[model samples]
Target: MDEFTSEELLEQLQQLDEQPRIEAKRASEIGKSVMQTICAFANEPGLGGGYLLLGIDEPSSVHESFTVCGVTDADTLLNTLQGNCREQFESPICVKGQVELLDGKKVIRLFVPELAPSAKPCTFKGKFDSKNKRKTGIWRRGLNGDYECSQQELEPLLLAKSGTSYEQIQLADAHWDDLDLSVIALYRTLRSKVRPYAEELQASDAEMLYALNLVRKQQDEWVPNVAGLLLMGKPLALRRLLPSVRVDYVRINGTKWVEDPEHRFATTLDLREPLLRLIPKLEATITDDLPRHFRLKEGDTQRSDEPLLPHKVIREAVVNAVMHRDYQVNQPILVVRYSNRIEIRNAGYSLKPEATLGDMGSKLRNPLIASVLYDLNFAETKGSGIRTMRRLLKQSGLAAPVFVSKVIENEFVATYLLHQLLGEEQLNWLTQFSHLHLTDDEAKALLLTREIGAIDNAGLRAITGLDTLSASQVLGRLHHQYHLIEQGGASSATYYQLAPQLQNDDQLPLFSGEAEASSEPNTSDLGTDTSDLGTDTSDLGTDTSDLNPATDTDLPEKLSQKIEQLTPKARRDKLWPVIVWLCALRPYKAEELATQLSRKETHLKHSHLNVLREQEKLIDYLYPEVINHPSQAYKTTDKGTNWLKHQGIEIE
Candidate 1:
């Protein structure tokens, strides 16, 4: 069974979206109902295995969310499932179950292993023809629910049980002539580059092809096999033999595939070539379509324009798509290129479990094709593909590649986000906390929380490539020392979300009215709504509290020194409490803040003021619905005042 954190499990349930290897049950008791799902999971043909979670209630109302109600009697359910597995089938099913608390409620999750071929077609009462509303023993999991497998679906499993790999099957209709000689020559050239001393380079055509398992002597004639047809077969041969063998490269203009019927893709390049030839072409096509960035290298006066995405990474992805895609599937590999990311969807579920995706060990569906590509220097061996992508993207300051492998969909999609992860904008934002000297791990934790709303120690490990201990340590330091994020959950299920202060800042609008008046989005506007700044500060609610907090005598030593070091824009963070505290006393207009702070109305109103109100939820609007009201004024809430006092900011 694969390892997944409870946080991840909860997240999946909350979304109420079905996962190929995940199922949820909200029942208080375990019976044949739960057993049916287990049978389906174990006998799920090609899907590796699946998990069953009990105690999470599905959404009962449109407005309500999926909630973790937890099992009422966990011990009874666990014992029931264990006893049934022991007594029900011809061979005992191997299932592992445990009780874990979700949102503090005890829930039972079961991991059902895919039964071995010999033990499959897991039936009730040791037979398929059970009459207790269970018509057949052979069951399959589908989009709706588990159902009895029909003859068509059950037939494939019988064939797969014979221990024959798909790629090794001989295509009786295909002859040696179907193989492309040019591709064979290219393979030899690449092999020589990799292993110059190899004697195979000097071998005859038929001998080399035979050695590569491209053509084998079948009875009296040399015939091409599935491997041969895939690695270097002629275009027409593939078109006729494997009609869906092609790559669809689509260029979308926005972040997502356009759903609007009227919108068309920027460009679409469809290539149907032999695997060896298609890879390089596919790599180049995607790279050419990508936007480039300029970087200054050593001894360079001018910036160099290189593809934003690494070419090597692109090659690995395209190669894997062709090499691992299920040719049995009558679907083209769709490479959707949006402006910000590239998505490569192949019609195959990873043979290896999702937990071991990046492990060096591999489970190849087509070893012969893999070997041919290896000799041709097209793709990496084992599972180095994902590791290489991670290393390269990290070096370029981009996100780690994301893999979505679903056995139910029988497809795998790899997403490569083209933008730099923590580029100039994020870097500038982090500088406000430069005083902490945050490590990459800590910074990443904060960034992820900002992006995903929350992150767990397990997710931190996934992103940082760190062990459990290291990830936890980084999370701990951030939570305890810097107090940047707040810890939630307990023990191994622990996760973290951004502290309220940061959450508040994150909620602020990207632009104030005055800031948007400019052509470009400016980060410099660090304070108020400059467009609404009035004449002066005299109308500052007649509150002396603002002047009192601003006085040198009232300021604390540590904070005072930091304020002096920060620029006017940076100072807004520490001084926001003061601003909000003053606003709590009485309603004040934007111009009043400018006068009290002795700062530019444009800077104060455009940058800090709106962020303090919107994100922090500290201040309220005089005309909340009418944001641009002429007489709009601001006042702080009790939550804002309490937060200030909690942070040790005080009124003298």
Candidate 2:
């Protein structure tokens, strides 16, 4: 179940190529042909998937040539083959290797599956050469050795994925009127751009369509491949054949999954043009004006710029989602729009087996169809789609798109953020702090503090997936970095909070403790964490207790202005005492401070009485603790007396 054995591979190679199948080659050792055969099999859809055996040969009597001729220098051969495969293949492909016995002789089997449809005409050293004109060429698994597929054959190979066989299909019953003249004209125009000799093939729109096999004869009438209908057939013709293939756009007012949606739309049309048209519309709806600082002739100038989402990012993401999505999955491609993000989740995993978005090699499951889309400018340059999207997003002041090729679900989800990336200031801090002496888990645990506001040791363990000891080490590092302050004991009961100094500071912290950790975590993770948390509003500029408007609400209009002018207290007791005396018993929402203190919500949004209590600025700790647990209470801060004097009230 895990790998093909050499003996099994030999049995496979012995079978003739009747229909699409695979060949497994096993060897204690192998040669260059092994690599060539792998590339060849990957190029041919007709071959399905192929394999290479690593060990075992037949009995000497059964076939001397195929007998167990134990390979010399096996380890060296393995390394050489591995290097060749890595350097030569356009995208890295795997060949399963396993040690086994054939006829009591040791051997190794190497299994090579044919390239997925997403990868067409398997390439060698970055070039697609099916004809074998170049010594360095790719191939289709032939009955004997690999054979080079010619350009004429290659075109059909590409087209076959479009689910058509132009060479055998012919349009008979349909007349000239049945063909969409506008579509035919557009095809002609596009064809001329790539093929200079297109004009010489003189034929009416109907004839041309038939000649190209876009419209084939079916029961004495014209028919089309799923691709042909999608690309050129009239809208009415397409609706009849490919109804389920479509795009769904869902818009939400916030980032979470359950937020209210602004609108939704589903499109079933010529995927190419309709998608291209859809980008600008989505952009117009969600795009925002961003504030930017620039150097002008007069002085440094600050102005607002257009939305952050780039045109190229939108197009590339859309194209990738459409091209690679599993048409068979029966799920419509989703374009999820949120207030600050856009996620495109298609219905299929990566065409390249076990591949991720970071991988740049080409292995398409539907190569024939993908090739056509690229030629028509509706898709990306092969192997560069994800990379291009990353570059574009970064250049436009947004974080790079996150690509997920989930194998279990067979889906590809690309998340694009319509927000600014780490600025030069943040980048400088990150770079300066890269050499900090901290473990990965510890850094993550500390970062969680900044993100979720607070985290206990147990929370750290869950977030980092570390055992108690390991989690403790991580929390200890956070404490040493001064980015976090320990709240409880050292054991599992320990809790932590953001350090007051770094709580709202722009510069990220760097640890100067003993080095005992792995390399620094990647910036991508940092970007992800920052995007999740809206902003740094962790610190309030003032104390909490004097906020009760009723007790302090009607003292005097002029006195209120005078009290506001007084210096803020360093302790919450200054005001908490009076507010508690005024209101016998009642609870308040964190956001209720604005109404309670007779101030605007915007002004008191960041201020909290609990926070003042924690800082010990309160006059008396009525609760003896101010963690703001599920229960509610209040206290007075140190500035309460000065405030009473300003308000024309004497403090007892």
Best by TM-score: 1
Query: What are the per-residue Cα lDDT tens digits for candidate 1 across 1-652?
Result: 4587655666654432235567777878877678889888988867667888888776676526667888887888898889988888766888988988889999998888998886677777745653543255767775345756655456446656776556767765788888898988887778888998777777898887888777789788778888888888898898778766777666655543432324444555557788778887777777666655556799989876667678888888888888888776555787777655677888788888666788898877777888878776777876798888889989987878766565655677676766554755567678989999999989987876665445665456666777545667788789889999987543322467778888777432211221223232121321222221132112111222332223544445654464456455556566786677667655677777676656687678656675565435567654332233334568765567677788776634
> What would the TM-scores of all predictions be?
0.58, 0.39
Report the C-alpha displacement of residue 190, candidate 2, in angstroms: 4.7
Which residue window of length 10 is worst by lDDT in model 1? Answer: 532-541
Predicted model with the maximum lDDT: 1
CA deviation > 4 Å runs, candidate 1 = 2-32, 45-111, 121-136, 149-160, 197-199, 293-305, 352-359, 425-652
